[model samples]
Target: MSQARPTFQPVHRTAKMPKAHTEVDPLLDALGGRGRYQLLQYFVSKIYAFTAAFQLLNFVYVARNIPHTCGQPNNISDIFTAIDDDAFTINNSDIFYDKCSIRVVANISGDAETKQLPCLYGYSFDERKELSIISDMGIVCDRAPLKGLGQTLLIVGQGVGAAVLPIFSDRFGRRPVHLISHMIVLALGVGVAFSPTFTVFLVLRLILGLFQQGIVLTDATIGIEVFPTRYRKLVAFLSNIGWCTCHLFLPLVAYLLRDYSWRILQLGCCSVSAVIILQFFFLEESLRWLVANGNPKQIKRLLKKAARISRVDYQHVLDVYDSLHSGHEQLDTKKEQEGTLSKEQADALLTEPVVHTVDDETHSLLDFIKDKRLGLNVAVLWFIWFTDSMTYFGLYFTSDALAGDRFVNVVLLIVVQMPSSVAIYYLVDSIGRKKTCIFLHLITGFGLVGATVVRELMGNTGTGAIISTAFSCFGFFGIFGAFGALFFYTPEIFPTNIRNVGLGTSSAFSRFGGMLGPFAGLLSEYVTWAPGAVFTCCCLAATAMVIVLPETKGKELPQTLSDVKGWYVTTDDKRRMDSIAKDGDADETPGQHGL
Candidate 1:
């Protein structure tokens, strides 16, 4: 027996293991990173942004107040007519005739006792160049509040939609949610135009707001997911430009339609939805979403299409899929060899040869809350979104009060933001997301505070007003830059699995801020400096909060909860060391694993 024994040699075999799901980034890179396919998706997403801007701000023109006076009583028609016809000849005693109340003098005597009465016959609006909801629905005087209520409810619906719709996007898919939202938005936008009553208009506006958010949230998610990390800042800048273009275009449309009915303007705005037809034909589902949600078939289909359109080798994409498929087989074989695979598991694996399931645990809002590090990140982002949105919409709502023509002031506000958006395009990639955010927040805070101080010191003179407007524009520039940066950064921080949910939640908070913005602008009516002061404080607070958040520039998009955990090293490292120690790898050092 001893003589029969022989020496044996050990052989090493190299197995091609499947890469992490996140490694799809490389696969995409090979398929031509930021290539034709990505650009096409980017442009399609921008179409939604373009139309949304028009719908979002159309209320400003549609609900503007026009010059009006109380309707004249039959008994005093001659007196009021003369007063209206000869504005200079009207005395102080005739002033009430031009207001919500009318002065009734007994017997038309010069010394007759006069009483102030509400406009009993309804208000008579002046012949103005433009018609508005104020004139059409008689939302004047006591009903003026209804105009603001419509706008507020629309924003509230946006908040609710942001909170809810993206959950479906995460669970079902981005493409279907995006397309369906666009269809609903197209329908609702037209419905808003033809609404028969003010009540119907308000309700439709609210629902329109909800679906509008769905389009926005999904489009942004798809836009970010499709492109490579290198192009995210550029993508964000282009989106801001699209938004600015719409703003510039909308005012022109409003001016041209000045003599037309609000319905005409609304219907014209709805025309932009025609782009949805093209989207249906061209837009593809997000590749990252497909990969994370365990749809290998869809991933292969999308990648192949991308390869065809992008002019990359088709076999490269197939090779990537094959690697993923091979990884699943190896995992199953090991499980079976270890006797951990049940009979049913082995049978299912044998039957479903191509389906490579990653972690099957579904995530929810609870995942965000239960995870301490993620929860902190989400809370900080919520606060930042709330404040940034509040300040942005607040400044916009108060633009008419600036020193220039109302239309010119709004256009200037939007134009000023263009430079900031361009600046952010460079700054975000250069200085990093956190620093860019902090710098922009400081600019916003300082600019707002300066405007408030100048307005207080100069006391409403023309010079003071001009200087204040400039400073406010400066603040607007900063806020717009910050807004773009936030949109770019938010998706990067959250992992692919819950990216839409995280963004949707932050947007929900921003919508709440937007809902409050009109009221914050109203604060200026009572406390002249209050809105600016409050906005400055918010900017400062957000700046401080931003310091604690992680920077995501140059990092590959995280694909799962485990990837997100790496953002906090102290916590993740401790857990990693514990797991390794329990697994009998006590000699492994943190540095060896690149922890």
Candidate 2:
């Protein structure tokens, strides 16, 4: 019996087609995939960008640490008064004055001791600019930790949303999940803006974070999957540009209304959220998704729309469907068995969409670490993703810590990131993913180290400020480049069934780093260079981890863990694709969808 078992045929079939002719999604590629149709869909999806830009960074001004001091009954409140009355060092570059206390006057005499007392009357804030939750809620000095808590908690909601929202996206559909998130985020933004109590505002921030992360990631997945491989970078590129555009606009809005209430800014940002409803009118569900779900009826309608938008004749595509792959035979079979059929009925049968058989097998997060190669890849990339967020949030969050004007510094941060994202889109194709990651990571580390060194050598003078700003710009540029390209790489490595979850979970892991980053920025209170130094070490460590991942550039996306487990899957899969490429309808992979 054992010997007879060996007599069976080999597992693999002989490949009859050329190796170079790999099969692709013909509907996406062959029908002018990157045409205005797909391009328009990609661009319209940027409404999420506007929401993200204003919502994500809204915390910056909302919690900005304006000038404050001890709550005296009727004495010095302004910083200038404290300096004039000899309460503080005259040109206190080091801020040697104790902000928590002030010298009091004897009944009718001169000066008294620097009495260490709390700001019991509630400290007054520099309200020349925007009124914020900080000014209203008194989240100062002792309550300063609450600022970090608020930021961290907001990311907590983001983490929860990242894990939960994508499940809805994968199970039901991307559109519904996104639309729901949009509505909730709109309501939450308004709620946070007009929140009467600090507790309510914090709670709303948490809820807002959750919905914001969900909407952005789901929209990102839809945008990416709609395009064929050749135009994928365009989607990523446009998204970054959209985010940067919003950031630039935000600063202008903040500056213009600096003397006004912060609620006005929140209302302005929420107003842009109306664009989400407009998406419902024009955006169609993914054709690939329809094919996978075996909805030939909807698939046909959407395919016709795509074809028309691409300027191709819809009837010619229909004719091809009618002529291909036992299409007429299947319709005839149904007609004979059931008696007669109408034109629409026959047409529905003509479009024999490829239906994906669901796999009973499941993938767990720990499964990412159990497979030898996959585990190692997951661990390393998770670290890279972590550092990506740390450096990103750390840079901007630390803007106030820097010597220059906060607005100009933030604007510079965004301006530098713009070119880096663009550079990576073009550069990833040339240098390969491994080198791109390592090189950019090293550059970021160098900028951190360089800034740390200059700040130490020259002290925090104007010259040192210029030098530090230059280096920080370098770090920001590198961080943006590496982070943007990594998004393309991370999802491409995971299989489709778990792709949304995988991206979501990895994002949650990145949020772990983000949650801690603001605290690192807060460390600037103790030492000027602490945040940069800590972030540099983290970036350098990530540089080493970059090499553990295999080069994925110019490769077909891995369809399953089996595809990732061994090299043979790539070779075998390509052979199978080549064999089916000659017949477009036959090329659709069995039990597979978009990939």
Candidate 3:
């Protein structure tokens, strides 16, 4: 009933002798295994952890030194007792002095003697209405020039450190550079703790910023490099989470320790720094840097260690490594299958792909700006960074104008920022880069606008104004949280060769913005509310300008400028060109103008 099937006779053949050498894994053979990358990422995260801990410690140190004690100083109370101070009729409730340093006192009616003085620090008191404003002259008399400079220097240092970190990371390895940064910060902490004069303390604060730059730069660079391209944003963003967390607790620290001396805060920070130094010693150098430096032995050992920790089989890891180095092994499968290969055949089959490696040599700064794309991106990032810091620090410094309860206002501001920071780390990878940036920028701009409206409505009103102020705080806080993520995003867009340079330029502009902050305050004195309006406008501009940027969500890093531009070129061609340059094999002949 069915069609007859065709039958064929099997042909007998003799088995061929196997070749002396053969390749097992071609894909793995071309490039090294994934283990090196994995280990490097792990090291990067640890570096972030240490830096985060130190940053928190710095905040804690500052909180403890606030100069307010819950109870009276022992000597004063004891001396009073010895003198039979009960003659003064001081009760226990009145005996305890509250910490009220660094407060804004409102002066009403412009009279030096008869004017009412409102204590900006009385938010915790039940009889809040008892506070009354003193005259503007009295208010002006209360604030010291040294106090202004102190605030200015603290922020300026932050700007400078962030701007220059890229250079430190690229030159010195991340671990050593961070350790040095920690030492510098620790010293600054000590200086801030013990300085008898305000001027010396302010100067030291600026110096502390220089060291802080290394902390931020090295941690960021290492963090980005260690992770897979897909996770770089997440790592960078999560790293920012530490900053937000520090901010959230800032209010609590300011409240609980507000009564203590500032020196105590610095001492606590120094203690934390010592602990961080110990934790950091166990951290390994970036495996990425080691491999890029062509340290095979170290790479293998690091990979083996990571595998052991990850609970992966050592043999399986070895197989992956073997596959990665197959080209290096130089297996001659075809010749071996036919017959044993002669020396000439072995040599011919053992061909290797050329790789261009970076040399540990100094380069000119001009080299960073050689490429147009890099230069433009750097410029764009600079504006974005400048605006970001301007809005964030500017608003925070002026919190007194918006809310009646300064402590609660600042704490609320910091708390709202934490979730936004955590969200950025989570979404940087899940959502594409461009979209995420655009969305956040838009939100920040609107948030600032919303804050302005609230500020306007709060125009000298009482309880209602206070409530509106808290809502506005929410908006301002979100803008700052977005800023933390942007710090990492700008650096990640560039190639390794120019990444540090690009980031440095951007960060420098950011510092410039910080330097200009005190000026903004001065400007506000001349034109009230103008700075806030300008900040809102800048946010809008940054948000819109971000649209012009090319999306780099999951793209592989290019080896050359042309590759980076997505110009037509194969990976092999780029590799060959790099090798020729490194080996000095190519003549120094001029190429076509465009290339």
Candidate 4:
């Protein structure tokens, strides 16, 4: 028997294996992910971030209020001299300088008696500083409440636009909406600078807010969709860095134009929007969008161009795309002819790929809420966005209240964000999205709570002020880092069909937080610890919420609703899927099993 076994011959197999079509990620990788094409896309998309930062923070300087006194009444020509010599005192002593009313000695029945009179004339502003909306429009005194109206309206417009514009992007396309919004922003921005009155300025600011948020949404959408998953973190970092760069330079620009009209600063900020003209020539539509929306011709054209720039083989990419669409049916026919696959195996392999069609059926926020798992995810993202905006803008609006020079404080706040962005660039890729988000939230919560404790214990002493500023910088570092992470994470969670819609909805919530941010600073008047405490609580709550979200780091961006549904699953669902997979494997025909 041993001699016979040694003489036995080996059987040869001759079954031919079918070629598999590449998936989107693998196809993109083959076309050279993170290549020159991706870089060019990133560069163009990020230019809008710079302009957005400029518009958002410019108001801090543009609406600044300076010390002023009631002007001399036209009836009393020399009242200014009398007031300077202390002959007149402030009637409304409740206010430090009684900027609204002045006390004057009246010759009532030939007896000197002091009487209070309103400033019928305009205000006398400090000549040392440049003019602001407050000084130019006399927004002080009784009109002081109007100081923040422009900024408030701007934020309100952003909220409204965020709620509305992304629907158009989702329906039409990201590129058209982005370019149109950019052009409108430029026009509105210029219109704001040339505003004839504060009313006109306020109207323009509101309109500018709408288009600016549009630019933000569309730019981020296009940016995230064009790049491969691995490069998304990098895309997010670059977007943040662009904002930080503009933020860092904004104070310097304001300082240089300190002696000029606020309108000059406005004009200068709008000038950056001129970059849009270049985008008209260079920017490409998102390849992911092209695929999901079924613009195969455009996809092929984009792939060919990308291949040329990336120096990859265009024919190979075309072949992959061609096979991806047609291979299953063609291969199934061959397998059926050969009679190699069992009925179940053939049915499994023949199942059509999920296609996201642009139909009349609407995809809205309601759809997000209707799906239990997605609703939970969206709800968590809303809270995170709300907290992020509240803390970020809250800290910014209150920068002048910090210990150091106002300019220095603003600069420090902006500078710290640079390192925060860089840290997120690394942490999101290394620790993963869920952990990174949680870690950043904890840092923010602790930093803010620590600052509140220190401020409460030490009061407003010089030491306390310095320590509080340091703590604020620490907290801001975390919030800014979390912000960058959100940009990367939000897009990954949503499918291509509704990516803009989901991000837009989240941004709308953030605008609500932004609208409340200035008011958060006002809370310090009643409770010194109120703003910090609110921000800390928000951070902690966001941390707890983050723990429930699935980790998205290094995962491919979902293309359809089906892909998203698979991400967060129950134990039962996982088991069912596994069982089905196992049963299919067991039923597979011999010599036709997957390699």
Candidates in order have lDDT scores of 0.77, 0.68, 0.53, 0.75
User: Looking at candidate 4, what is the lDDT of residue 128?
Assistant: 38
Model 4 agreement with the true structure over 1-595: per-residue lDDT tens digits = 4553222111111121232322467567767788788788778877886678788778877888788887755555445454453434343222122577766664444467565657666777776333687788777778889888889899988888888899888878888888898989889988888887889988989988988889899888888877777788888788888877778878888888888888888888788788897789878887777776777778888999989988988999887777665654565554454445545454444453431222222355676567876788899999999999999888876543444564676677777888888888888889999999999889888878877888899975689877777777788889989988898789888877788988998898998898888887679888988999888889999999998777888777876664555454322244544554555433332222211
lDDT of 1 by residue, 301-364 (tens): 8888889998999898788767765666666564444344443443344344343335444566
lDDT of 2 by residue, 474-581 (tens): 888899888887777777676544566777877878888888777765598788789888889888889888877777776655444554543443444656655544
Clashes of 1: 0
Error of 3 at 39 (Å): 9.2
What is the TM-score (0 to 1) of candidate 3? 0.66
| Deviating ranges (above 4 Å) for candidate 3 | 1-143, 163-165, 249-259, 314-365, 399-410, 457-471, 518-521, 557-563, 567-595
**Per-residue alpha-carbon lDDT of candidate 3 for residues 1-595, written as tens digits (9 for 90 to 100):** 9986533211111111111211212212222333453444445434444333444334323421122212233354442443342433223212323343221122224422211222232223222111211110111223324445554665577667765666666555666777777777777767766766555766887777677766666666666655545556666556666555545554555456444545654564355456454536455665455543446687678667666655566667665555545433333333243234443443343332322232233343355356564456556777888887777667655654434454566456556666777667666677866667667767766655655566576662676456545645655655665566666676556555455556666776777776665466677777666776788788788877777665666664332343344422222245444554456443331222222
Clashes (N, CA, C under 3 Å) per candidate: 0, 2, 24, 0
Error of 2 at 392 (Å): 2.1
* TM-score head-to-head 2 vs 3, winner: 2
In candidate 4, list every pair of residues with a backbone clash. Answer: none
For each candidate, give its TM-score against the true structure: 0.85, 0.79, 0.66, 0.85
Evaluation by TM-score, superior candidate among 2 and 4: 4
TM-score, prediction 4: 0.85
Which candidate, 2 or 4, has the higher lDDT?
Answer: 4
